[model samples]
Target chain A: MASAPAGTLYRGGEGMWSWVAHRITGVAVFFFLLVHVMDTALVRVSPAAYDAVIATYKTPIVNLMEVGLVGAVLYHALNGIRIVLVDFWEPGPRHQKAMLRGILVVWLLLMIPGAYFMMIHTIEYLFGSTS
Target chain B: MSLEIADPRSPGAVPSGRARNRGNFEKYSWIFMRVSGLVLVFLVLGHLLIMNVLDGGVQRINFGFVAGRWSSPFWQTWDLLQLWLAMLHGANGMRTVINDYAEKPSTNFRLRMLLYVVTVFIIALGTLVIFTFDPNLA
Candidate 1:
């Protein structure tokens, strides 16, 4: 029985993938948070020190990275809610697959506008703005 | 022949129940994740909206902007709370991750110690920055 073929237990699917994604995104975001807190702490040193470092964050490459960071945060946040629902809500486990769909849909809806807003400065800086 | 039924809720199966019976620390950490996660969904999202999406986005952030924001007690409190909660939540999450993946007991202990050290350092630094911020320093 130990070495038998897979059974009814969930092996790999939407639920499993989401769980993997959650761990990856969580670790990534956690590391970013560490660096961010360090950078923000530079404000205590001197304005020159803080501004000099922050200027790099405004560069085109880093700005693009910011969008990626936002995307990761959004996914983690949405999927986190779904996880909470599955744990707390009575019907959540039964409908977890559907919740995954809802999370993806909402994530897309938010990311579209979010990415646009976050990238506006980068876009303008790269290709000269009309206004 | 006797029947051998498999227990779905075995000690190894339910991490939460296992933690609960062991001690209060792990169980509280589990509850902390859910509560802090829910609060962070709003706090972090709002922070990203204001800092990364509003106005000129990242380009407009600098010492002056940070100074202005921290000048308000409300933003200061918001940031302080964010720093503490996010740090603790992330630390606990990382602890669980290390426990799961580290095959060697020694490696797990060392990694978790490092995580705790980093977590404490960052939280202290962030809190100090927020509290001791001087608008006129610039």
Candidate 2:
């Protein structure tokens, strides 16, 4: 059953894609949260230990990954709101597709500025000293 | 042409039922998701703003910044609540996905076992980290 040539389960529609994306982002965010909590807790270990760990985040590669993290978090959160509405609102089920489109726009509006703000430092760090 | 009424309520169906042996677990989970989600919107956004967008942003984050923040009981409590709420919210959401996707009984059982174990482990570890934190540790 795991291997099929024709079809196993139907996976189509924007709603299905949204569900897939939601699950993927949800897992990504959770993994990041786990690492984040552990690192934040390092403050209690020793100031130097925490400082050294956080200093590594300033690296160009890590800074670049920050953009992806921000995107995942923003989408996960906005989609989460849509899920709540679909679960509770009277017209939610009917309007879920509309909500998806609305959230996509909202996510772009928020993330565009967010990305600019987040990446400005990295951009400077990456290209500033090449001279 | 005639049509056949397939058993849509098959055990492997998507969201076969929202209820189980647990006492209103699904209902409360639904309610919890909505309430936690609304609150999390504020808490998570405020967190992102302060930690990643504010003056100095992630660059300024270090032991001292965290030590200063955690010194206050208010911030400690806030972090603690955010930890619990976000963990539970995300874990519960994953539980729903597992239920929907794990079609085989054996697969479902093992997947849920792993999920529960990992969820409980992370929550326990995070709670311990929050409550036992010592800013003065040297």
| Candidate 2 CAPRI grade | acceptable
Over B7-117, each residue of candidate 2 has an lDDT whose tens digit, in order, gives 667845543443334678778998898899888888887888788776757888887788788888988888888888898888888788888989998898898888788
- State the TM-score of the second chain for every model: 0.83, 0.82
Compare the candidates by lDDT and give the number of the best one. Answer: 1
Chain A (alone) TM-scores for all candidate structures: 0.90, 0.85
For TM-score, the strongest prediction is 1
DockQ (model 2, Cα): 0.47
**lDDT of candidate 1 over B1-138, digit per residue (tens):** 899655667845545544446767777888999999999999998999999998878889999999999989999999999999999999999999999999797898899889999999999999999999998885
Interface RMSD of each: 0.9, 1.7
> What lDDT score belongs to each candidate, Candidate 1 first?
0.89, 0.80
Clashing pairs in 2: none
Q: Estimate each model's TM-score.
A: 0.88, 0.82
Candidate 2, RMSD to the unseen true structure: 6.8
